[model samples]
Every structure is written in C-alpha cells, then in structure tokens.
Target: MNWLNYSEACARNQAVILAELQPLLATTTRVLEIGSGSGQHAVHFAAALPHLRWQPTDLAAHLPDLGANLLRFGSDNIDPPLALDVTQEPWPAGPVDAIYTANTLHIMGWPQAVALLQGAGRLLEPGGLLCIYGPFRYAGRYTSASNAEFDRWLQQRDPCSAIRDVEAIRDQAHACGFALERDISMPANNQLLVWRKAV
Candidate 1:
C-alpha cells in the first residue's frame, strides 16, 4: 500500500491538532472523519483518545490501504473504514457528535467543498463540531509561498483543484448554520478551523 505511507507533515502536525481537538472532543462519543486517506492519523488519534470513537471514511478506492493501516495500528477505538464521497447524493450515516477533515478541501473543487459543508450541517447534531485542517488562502491572497507553490501543483494536476479562501469558507459555513469558533494556525502554513453548529 504505497498510498498508505505516513506524511512528514501529518507526523509533525497531528500532535498539535490533537491538542486543539482534545478539549472539543472530550464530550464527544463518536466522530466521523471525512477523507481518511492513509488512515495513519485515524489510528494515531483513536489510540491517543480512547474515549472518543473514530469513524474513518474515504473513497472506495482508498479503503484497502486505509483498512490495512488501521489493522497495523491495532486500535479498537477506530472503526472499520466506510466508503464516503461528500459530493455524492447521500452520506452513509449521520448525526455524529463531531466531523473532522484534514487536508482535503483544497484538493477538491469548490462545488465539492460546498457540498461537504452542506452535508456536515445535515449530519452533525445540534452544537456538534466541524473541524477542518489545511492551508487556505485568505481574502484572495495566499498565506505563504509554500502554499502558493502547492496551489500551483494542485491546479497543474487538476485544474479544478486550488487553495480555497478562508473567508469564503467561513461564509459558506455560516450559511449552513455553523459558527466559526477558531482559526488556529498550524505548522507548514496550515490552519485548523473549528466550527460549531448553532443551536
């Protein structure tokens, strides 16, 4: 499973993300992780936080690698991966305590990102958390030179793929009844945006 290799960025950033997430997740019983690529982060977080159950989901094509990574880590708190594509008509299951997605938004087109937020709004319980982790543009400007290069690389691979604007994302989230709580700066020019569904 070459695709299952751990990212150096994931290694450097997971602990920081966990620190921010630990408080919000303390009361959460279950979390639905969107785009659980490689599954390294899933297993690591699940093992670290035994109280919160982690449900990993990704495209069907990535499931085998995800499953293998989960098994190799051997954590009971992590559930078997589910096939999930946010742009699809219906989500697999719903009403989770929290939803998390890392480094996925910019990889997908704007329509898919909007659909993902809309789906989260539909699936989250009242006041549930929606945490998105990755680098993003702000007010039509790139945050860093690295992100600019990354954006170029993404667009080169798929013209529809490019770094998103944080303000625009917050606007969409607000429209979906999700209130932005925090925008924590992370390593490697990334950020962790935390939102809560308004009651």
Candidate 2:
C-alpha cells in the first residue's frame, strides 16, 4: 500500500532535531519512536547515529509503508517496526532507554496525549528520556505566526487536533513522574521538549 503520501513541516526539521538529540542520546542503547510516520526520521537518525538502536513503531496499518521507507535507507541500526497505539488498553512492548515522538501530540486529542505520556512514563526506565518535537503554545501565546496558522489548519481538520499548551504538557509529565529537562527552540517554529523520568 502507498499508505497516503504527504509531507509535513516537521519532517523538514529532522536534521535540526538530530543535532540536539545526538549528544543527549550518546549513551542510550535503545530508542522507541512513537508515531513513526513515513519512517523518514527514524531511518535518517538511525543511519546517522549507528550506536543507538532505533525501534520504529506505529499503528499496524502504517507498518508497511514505514518498513518500506526503512528499507530504502538500509540502516542496520533500525529494527523492524512494531504495532503500537497509545490509546490501547495495554502497550505491546517492554521498556526502552528513550522514547521519541515528533509532531504526534497535536495530532491526537487531549486524552490520547495524556495516555501517551502516561504510557511513556510506564515504559521508560528511571532516568530515561522522553523527547517530543513539534509546535506548541506557550504562556497563552503562539510562538510564531506560522505555528499559529498551522494550529488553525490542524483544528480545521480535526477539532481535537490543535497545538497543545506547553504548560499543560509539563504538568501532565510531572504527574506522570517526569521532570522537564529542556525546551529547545528549533527551526520552523517547532520546539524540542526533553523530559526525564524521575529517578
């Protein structure tokens, strides 16, 4: 299946995210990527950072296209894709050294986002990292005009899919036993949010 071809602004920012992620993930042995859409970022990062094993996962329907993209890159470090849905009653896998998801939260409703964070907390070992990348609202304001427009487009497509407030996300992370580590601003108005599981 072609699996619905489309491009996202987030995909264009992968290299910038990898630059920030590389140093923090230098010692990480395994990384579980949620919502591995198109598998572009996973293949690119796994090829760039050969030391860390990248486990790309998404809904079962998305696996074929994701796998095909991974094959295109031919990176040994990227493991076969896994079927994972945050809203499911139980996750399908074990713990991971780190969890990464880009531009997924805004695509999901608030409840699903909370469930994803809770599941991440459960799967991450103490001191493990959770990295989320995407545009977000901060202090009741949009960080950029482009992001504001993107949020409008998102809500138009799905009322539940709107740019999330950073503060609310931080609060949810805290409730899930995660501590906010860094909020790095990236190109194209996106932000890289790093949270560490409390030790």
> What's the TM for model 2?
0.94
After TM-score superposition, what is the CA distance of residue 137 in candidate 1 from its true location, in Å?
Answer: 1.1
With a 3 Å backbone cut-off (N, CA, C), the pairs that clash in candidate 2 are none
Model 2: how far is 60 from its true place, Å? 1.7
Runs in model 2 with CA error above 4 Å?
A: 1-11
Those runs of model 1 whose alpha carbons end farther than 4 Å from true positions after fitting are: 1-3
Query: Residues 1-199, candidate 1, lDDT per residue (tens digit)?
Result: 3436667777788888898888889999999999988887787788888998899999899898888888877498888899999988679966698999999999889999999999999999998999999999889899899889999999999998989999889999999999999989987899999999998
Q: Rate the local accuracy (lDDT) of all candidates.
A: 0.89, 0.89
| Residue 9 alpha-carbon offset, candidate 1, angstroms | 2.2
As a TM-score, model 1 comes out at: 0.95
lDDT of 2 by residue, 39-152 (tens): 878877988889989999998998887788777764899999889989895787667889999989999999999999999999999999999998899987999988888899
